[model samples]
Target chain A: MHSEKELIDGCAKGDRAAQRAFYERYCGRMMALCNRYAKSTQEAEDILQEGFIKIFGSIASFRKEAKLTTWMTRIMINTALNMQRQKLYLLPMVDVNDANLYEQEEIGLSDFHFTELIRMVQSLPDGCRIIFNLFAIEGYGHKEIADMLNISEGTSKSQYNRAKSLLQAKLKAEQKYENVRGQKL
Target chain B: MKTSEDRNFEEEWKSALDGAEMAPSDHVWNSIDLKISHAEQGEMKKRVLFYQRVAAASILFALCLGAAGWFWNYEDASVKSLASQTVGENQKESASSIAKVPFSNQNSSNSSAVTITESQNANSIKSAVGNYENGVKTRIENGGKNHALASEASNGSDIAAMIAPADKNVLTLGKEAELESRRTSQSNTGFENGSVTELATNGLSMSAIRLTGKPVEQIESARTFKIAKKEQSPTDDQNRNWWASVNGSGGAYNQSSSSNSVATSLFQQSATSTFYAAPNSKEVGVGTSFSYGMSMGKKVANRWVVMGGVNYLNQSIDYQTNIVLQDASQSKAFLADLASLSSNLASTNPYVLRNTNEFISVPLQAGYLLLNRKAGVQLNAGVAADIFYRNTMTDLSGQFGSFSQAAGDNSVYRNLNWTGLLGTELSYKMNRHYQVSLMPGFRYSFNSVLKSSTGSTINPLVWDVGFRLKYVF
Candidate 1:
């Protein structure tokens, strides 16, 4: 396998094999980042393809000051945000009561499949889904999420809380259904 | 902003999706590869177009240079031939007038009327021209019967008195007339002493023949005599002491020093850093220079001439730097906010910048003629005050286009510079009025063209060969 610097140099020089290798190395992880922000698998794939194209085109300008993964992750996040920016402009975010912020509990997610967890996150409202992913999963502060989406900090906080409560209620219902099935069996 | 309860909930979700990976559809990579291929082709096409434009510009400049030289030579030849033809026609008229004098004495005086306009100091010279005219008219009217009567009117001593005046304002015979008079004196019998002897001797002979008791109709056939007067002086030639010229030159220019100023450091900054980094290496190469202008000069002394003119000068320096080329609009950001820039700000491709500086130069020069002849040589020395106009930074590789900045209060270039000049000119006189010269010159700037605030030094030295076409006014 070629080293990261050699692969980057080759891709910058338009080496097709190096470009393919670069894509293959990072596509899976980038696809997962894209999926968290996208509403569907098809939209997630679209974001991943566009993000990789940007990465390749601007590769000559990359100075390698940041870690390769960190730089690529930033590009993926920017691309996903751009794809969802238009919908975010049209859809108004729901403002729940602040009581939802204090009602959080320690929940066990070890039994949930990663795909099922992604589906639960994606199933939230467009504004709530993006805020919850940015705040809970990506560890971005609510103020930073507000600035990125051009929304207020209060709106970001209320939306994340609503999304968390919705996910907890769904997980509890699923656990109850599984227990019922086990009893019947 | 995260509370303890919220932290645990976020931690559980974050760990659950921490290493999530999914396989995208196969078509995504194929589409990206195709788009990148098309982009590479587009870049190649753009580069080809840039080279084509540069080639076309070079060809046009060559054609213009060739056409200017051809036109100058062609014009000189045509004008010289026309001047020779006019001199020949004037001689023929003087000869025909001499042969016709015996038939009409009154008409002879009219034909030979010399309009003498002397300087204010020599106002009495007009009467001298009148006395010479009356002497010839009296001899033609008397129809000379004896050699003594003919000698009295055509006396060589009297003609000498008219020529050697106190103010020297009398008519001076042209070179052609002096040569013709010598031929007549060698062949004829009498009157061989003064400037006008040739025409007087011919007139007397024609008058004596016509008065030989022949009938009117018989003498009419013998009245084929002609007389011509061609009076010219070298001192009175128009624009003999004042001349005007247009000149053009091409040369190589060299910079004797380099600058490590704040401006250069700003431009040499690395692509990713907020603060500009020092250049890894610096190379300053010699570049081409060109100038063209017109000047007016006057002969101040016997062998000295002085001139002053405005010239447009273009000087260039080839600068190769590793600094990533950026848009000029980001200049304000260079000093204001380094953190505002993203990590992807810099490019790895290095480019050459041709620094082209333009100036309007006013030169005052004095020349001493070393060999003043048909082919003359002169030595000249001068100083020029060059007013800065603009400096253009061109990326020769065409990866980025060129930009220009005029000299202003905040500009790096100074508003004015001084240069010392020395040269020798080898010139050839094309005619009485036109001269063509080749001048090879050396020039050196007296001070740096850049402002002291920039902490840059650029003292350029140039060696140029110029072509000058001068016309006496």
Candidate 2:
């Protein structure tokens, strides 16, 4: 079965060493999860500490019905969600009250690297960046984007288009600048 | 004109972002560390305050419990001073007029829950709490007494034979500890026959009484004192410090189930035989500590902390006005100000006073450190005083808030107050620098606010779950 199950069984025998081993195995991965959902790295770390506490404290409950990582991920998500609510963070909604405002414009790719597109997506302003991420990379509709960002579906569609157009222009400008620099060199 | 192929090439451009190349600033670790430290400190302060209350309860339990047939208190000053000296350690001592048959608190980690109080007119000095505690040494001693009581229940059966060499059944610590004790030393007042409830209410001058029919080989009651080592053997008094505190004491509320009465008695017996076994070997250290930890996770353990260096463990309850206003009017105004949203003016203001509130609190706790480490978590309880720290308010501005005041100075605050710590860290060694931690658990406070300044009041009872960390060096 799962490695955690064996470790847990060992711990049930009052094996302090096993318990310590268990803690070390998950601390890093949990910290990574904390980093994603936290407003600041510290806040995420705080969530990590709290999460591990619950983990070790409640280790007896871990019957190994699911993978250890899965169980830990759930705790991490819950902690992050709680922090988000407590800190009044800007979290994207999953569902939508509005419909998709913009249809995806198919810009066929021949030689474009996926990383360039991702960077372009990342470079957008907060509102636009989120909208593009939800629409382009995540494949969410405008309505879903609006719900998550707490904005109008129209705003989502407009922002997505604006992001795409801005990205296209930036790339073209960068390409021209590079060619000029190459000639001079 | 550009060809269709050229146009296609020009329009489509993409590059995959490598995870490592786009790494954020490395100093992010420091930033994360700062917040984590801040939150951890606040949480630690809260927990220690809670532990202090429980310690108080445990001390009180040691007094109220007559299960061991001990003369609860003696009417003498020197003895009372001894008990009162442990006041800083615990705040929940009561005066019972019961006899001091071999005193057994089911929760005593220390063999004898001996304490010397220094209260102004210390009654229980020689009576009950006397010869036992220091202000800071009071709580842990009592908690240890109670802990010993519980532990005795589990292991007493094993140690009973150790008490008397003739008997194979080493006197189980907590088992059958009913030594005949009486509170009828004075006239014919409180005691109906030989039975009395408390030793001396607040008057700790209760005397010791035991019917030693068990045939002791000696005349004077056997009392054992464990001597310190050649090195600076950190007395409980020397242990209390500002920077670090080790709080293993949880709570002293349940007197009947107190492990001290059993454990302390057994340990006392065992301690008497210390010449055979090393005191250092049986010694489990009590540490006092001060530390700051940042909660390093948002999902499970989100926190931030900052270090405050101070030696005083006094608890005061002060109110803070926290204002939580949901302003739909402001939102509408902003929307109106944005000329673009004028046409779609159907949206109304979402801001209306949702929750205008106030909180009441009494924060209680006592703190001290050993070798610069805060002490708590094992001995299992402590004592503290509490007051109010108000944080909720609805002022003249018609705004809702968790804390805010239009009249006088208003702000939301976490004033250290009184609380009862229930469970403690079951000893977990972390990094070399920080070894102190707790088994996650809950704390209950008689008062609401955990802390307070001068004249402020608020209700504050928070059920917090986080680790208490400390630096050993």
Candidate 3:
């Protein structure tokens, strides 16, 4: 297997074998990252392919200052964001005051599987889901998220808070249902 | 700055999603590959078109310059020829006056009878001789005085002396004489020294010949002298200080392919070589070329004209190839990846590559007049630098066949190359100012279009035929 530098050089030259090796090495992680921004598996795959094409085309300009995976992840996220923006632009903006903030629920993290967590995140509205993912999982500041999404910093903060409250309420409801089912059993 | 509750939620989500993985379908890669290929082809086409436009503009500019130069030259030549003709007529009149004095004196002195009939016969003879000499002198003066003096001095020195005014009276003949002379001398003399002074200054022996015969016989002998003088005049070659012309030409060009085995080996070594293999199998069609220019020439010698000017050349070559992909299965696998990713790869056909390369050249050339007459021929040769403007190639291999690529890197090929030119021009003078010409020419390149060590080469040899309209000044 080639090193990151060699892989980049080969990809720049349009070497199919090197491109395949590079794809295989990073596609799993990159796809998982894509899944966070996408609403469905198909959408995630589209973002992944778009990101890879960008990576291959611009490999010649890639500087080694950042990790290759980091660069690829950034590209995937940006591609997904661009697609989301196109779709989301037509939809009406949700006011922060309109969001229903529920009480926080004390549920154990272990109660939810990784797949269940992904589904819960995906279920959020496009605006809130994007904000939550950027802030919570991607560890970006509200300012950066606002810039990336072309929204105000206050909107990013409010949307992130709304996403958290909604998820907490759902987890609390699921735990309560489980308790009732256990009694019936 | 996150609250304790927010921190806890973030940690929970992070741990839950940790090590998560999902594999997209293989079809995604296939779609990406197709997109890249299409982008490349589009870029190539755009570049080729750009170069083509540049070449065309350059040629057009050159043609305009050529035409403007020719027009200016024609107008200048017309003015000059007219001025020279007027001066020639004036000199003829002065020369005839000198020629008439000797003939009239001989006729009058020879007639012995004072009877009106005899005197009238003598006057009639003098008038006939005067008319004959007027015609001869006009032609001789148009031939220039040096030629006339050189050939006719021995036979007509007395007549020459009679016409040459004494140095003191030559310029001071005053308004009356000048006006009278203009009326009397049909061919005027603008000569600085009168014909009499010209003969005396040259130190030629002036002997009067006595005629004892009929006046009609003397006139006949004079006519023979005029014919002999016309034959002795120098060949008519206008030595204009400056001349200009405009010309346009078109021709066919062929570019020789590169022969570097090393680069060919490298191309074959790579499994996914973007460079084409078996370039020779591809057809390189005949190239189209055009050029236009305006030149200014100086008459350096009796039969030599030296000229230099700017010329614009637009040249283009077309190359087409059908390249078979080495591994069909591998491509299928790539497409499968893209399909799995939910992106479709539309094309699976063999790749067809088409490329067009354009160049604009500016040349400075010098021409030598091999023949000069009402109809003339010239030979010209020069060297120029050519600028490679664009190289565009389209690849149509996928099912949709809409993929294109433009090579934007001029350094990949020889952006600048030297050209050697040789040509011959045949011209016909329509009048004093306007001339029409047909030029056949050839151009040879000193460098290949491809950069050194690329294993691919394109060296073009061009032949051209041109029609030119010229105005001489």
True contacts kept of each: 0.89, 0.11, 0.72
Q: For candidate 3, give the lDDT of residue B15.
A: 74
- Residues B265-316, candidate 1, lDDT per residue (tens digit)? 5544633444333222233445667899998898787668898899999987
Q: Write the per-residue lDDT of candidate 1 for residues A117-168, one digit (tens) a residue.
A: 8988778878888898899988899889889999888899889888898888
Candidate order by TM-score, decreasing, is 3, 1, 2
Judge candidate 3 against the unseen true structure and give its global Cα lDDT, from 0 to 1.
0.55
TM-score of each: 0.43, 0.28, 0.47
Q: Is the docking of candidate 1 incorrect, acceptable, medium or high quality?
A: acceptable
Candidate 3 CAPRI classification by DockQ? acceptable
Reference-based lDDT, residue B25, model 2: 36
lDDT of 3 at B71: 60
Q: B249, model 1: CA deviation in Å?
A: 29
DockQ class, candidate 2? incorrect
| Lowest lDDT block of 10, candidate 1 chain B | B142-151
Which candidate tops lDDT?
1
Candidate 2, residues A63-104: lDDT per residue as tens digits?
Answer: 577777777777766666555553334544232222332232
Q: Please estimate how well model 2 matches the true structure, expressed as its whole-model Cα lDDT.
A: 0.35
